[model samples]
Target: MIEVSDPNEIAALARDPNLDRRFETPTCPVNWLLLKRSLKVLSFRGHRFPTMMPRDDAQRTSNQQDLWNLLGEKVASIKTGSDELEPLADWVRGIGPDVQLGILVQQLLGQLFSSKFMATEASWDAAKVLVAAPRLNNLPLMMWWFVSGKVRRAKRLLAGMVNEDLSAVNAIGIAVHNVVKSLRQMRVLYANVQTRSGLSAEAAAEQCLFAPASVYRQATAAGQLGDCPYSRHSLFVLSIGEAARHAEGRSLVFMEDSWSRCPANLWIPAMLQGVWNRASVFSQFHDEKLSG
Candidate 1:
């Protein structure tokens, strides 16, 4: 493990955030290898695009081509899975966007053990590399096979270094997954009292007026009935009751967390209810009485 000898060094790097861009001048081991990997992943499943995956491209610029060749050589030389990551991660952090590199490193480390979702046979070497992977996404991927019986895909905007509490990362992953899944449906979007500082459950209730009655009902029923602080700029979705009553294709509203001042956790259940409501409506429309 490369011990960061000085917090000041990282702090200094943060202070001049533009320092990463200096790599544009180009050099050997050109950071483009990490860049290409990051771009590949981002283009594939990132919010920005849907079609993306690994492939060979002869059209890549000379610098990018050189990096690709270097990566192939390094990957070929790497025996232990553990040996493939640290240097790659370090190189990633040194050049290219940190967020992008973090995602790629996490994906690479996860892929090393299993193609994507399956867990590799237990290997001490793979476990060690996963333990030291740079992102929380990697942690959850590692835990899925090793810890939990659930083989769910990891879905959190963790975007940075691995947090100290691995459980917290898991919780956040579950939370974000629930939230995004809810958004895809016409479920209720919840709000909270989060800030750059922190949040309180009490704050969640006090500002609950902005939420729909159904959302409040779900929140109250779940015993999640309080205002909790959320990210400064969070968006939520709520189904339109009138739209559902009319049997419309879909109905939802996007609102800001700050404006609603409600608990964000309530969003998931609200979504469940909306989906249930839509299903009920659909069944009624079909009028297919059961013979039972």
Candidate 2:
């Protein structure tokens, strides 16, 4: 396995035709088995999570492009200053000063998935298990979790909450969790900023837009990406979140220019900005009421 964190190298490697999302049979038998298990945990009812599907998957490509176009329409509408997100902003504003940050963010993002979506305390508990299952590096423990039905239960709860929409599952299950983490970070930064009024909502949102921690690719054949050399079936771990920390690495947040770029690139930042804007307004009003 090769781990890459440099922005330029990641960009070059991500665009390389030889490297793709499909996990080919690795040279190591143990690794190959582990990859198969990973795919199992990441899939539901025979459908691989959209993000986990191979690049060459025609159905995935077509469906994802449709989602992208839909998100683009949402972005355009949002840009017109609609009040569609005021409810979410109000939820953020109403958060108790000492509320559990993780749970609060998860609940807030859950609303974005669907108005019918509701996260109970038990759901949050299950989510912890579900989100961590894919990241477990131990084969034995992973197998034990699966066999013991722990993983299956968590997945069932998640699927039920999202009405079995795989895209919603992927978004809430794998993607927006990082966005939640970053929003928490942004909240801390907003609180500590000496000149909060000077920070635009858009700027504040951009300050916390985080990329996924990493994405994997497999080489179909021996090839060189920048200075890195890889053999067939070698796995490449692109450290997207790390690269996004660099000055010019912001684009990596959404992989904005890449073939695999996130569909919600514009919509996410806009939604975040709207939340921060409403929250700031509420804060100012509360401060004035207290002072008066």
Candidate 3:
């Protein structure tokens, strides 16, 4: 596992032939590879189109710019109050203009994993997918699999690294899964601390490692939720970049953490900048993009 953060470094690793690949598997009878591929497709759709995976690309560039502009405004909303910080996840939710986009994204992903709903070898219990908050959306389906251990399989995001050299890189770090657990832990740790500093969670984390007791307390108090004050920011940024890369058919950023740079560190600005490049010219628009 080569620890790497630089895009150039990761690109170098991508050229390596010895690199292995892996992904989390569904715990039930669902086909893991199929599910992964399906999610990848949905991710591509969500990132590529803002209007519930629209087929019209007449304003691709303008549309993307609009989305980003909207995103920027929403991000700025966080700094509007005296808090100067806001939950990243909630902020991302407030950006998109399309309300059905969430449903479309989930349904598409769910349908991709549809074999599980059948009586085939991949069949699962119907009770597992009640039409409720989670199952009503694929979020519940995904959560069920998380506990079942389907998505826990670790995959190497960087192409160039090997297992023996995971410790040598300065830009590398492990990605901590169990996001909610980590955030809740942070809540307990910083239940009664002040946060006026604008340093990001990443900064506070580094400070916590070797700072004095006063600094440790300050760092821990960075936020009441998330892994740090900017955990949501990290999540949003990482998800966008990962979805874009994965959508491009390069699954480099969606894997579990290793001794080296967490997959999130890899720089893929295209994910953010290419917000509205018209959809592929060769491909016809898709209307039946997803089915739950």
- lDDT of candidate 3 over 1-292, digit per residue (tens): 1123333334433333223122223322333433333333222212321211222234543544443454344332222221211222222223323332233222212222232211211111111121121222366666665566442221122101222122111011111112222233333323223431233443332222210000000011112221223211111111223232323323334221221122222211221111111111101133235331
- Residue by residue across 71-129, what tens digits does model 2's lDDT show? 77676556433576555455455454423544555555566567877666666666677
CA lDDT for candidate 3: 0.25
> Model 1: runs farther than 4 Å from truth?
1-5, 21-26, 44-292
The local lDDT score (0 to 100) that residue 186 gets in candidate 1 is 18
lDDT of 2 at 84: 60
Q: Give lDDT per model, in order.
A: 0.27, 0.74, 0.25
Best candidate according to TM-score: 2
| Ranked candidates (lDDT, high to low) | 2, 1, 3
Once model 1 is optimally superposed onto the true structure by TM-score, how far is the C-alpha of residue 280 displaced, in angstroms? Answer: 35
User: Model 3 Cα displacement at 31 (Å)?
Assistant: 12
The prediction achieving the highest lDDT against the true structure is 2
Residue-wise lDDT of candidate 1 within 1-292, one digit each (tens)?
A: 0112122332222232122111121212323333332232222123311111111222223323343354344432342223334433233223333233333333433342234332222222233233222223454564544345221122222212122222222222222232223322211212111230132223322221222212110010111102432221111112322222232211222212112211223332332333333333333454556433
Question: Model 1 clash tally?
Answer: 11
For model 2, the local distance difference test gives: 0.74
- Candidates sorted on TM-score, descending: 2, 3, 1
Query: What lDDT does candidate 2 reach at residue 159?
Result: 83
Task: State TM-scores per candidate.
Answer: 0.18, 0.87, 0.24
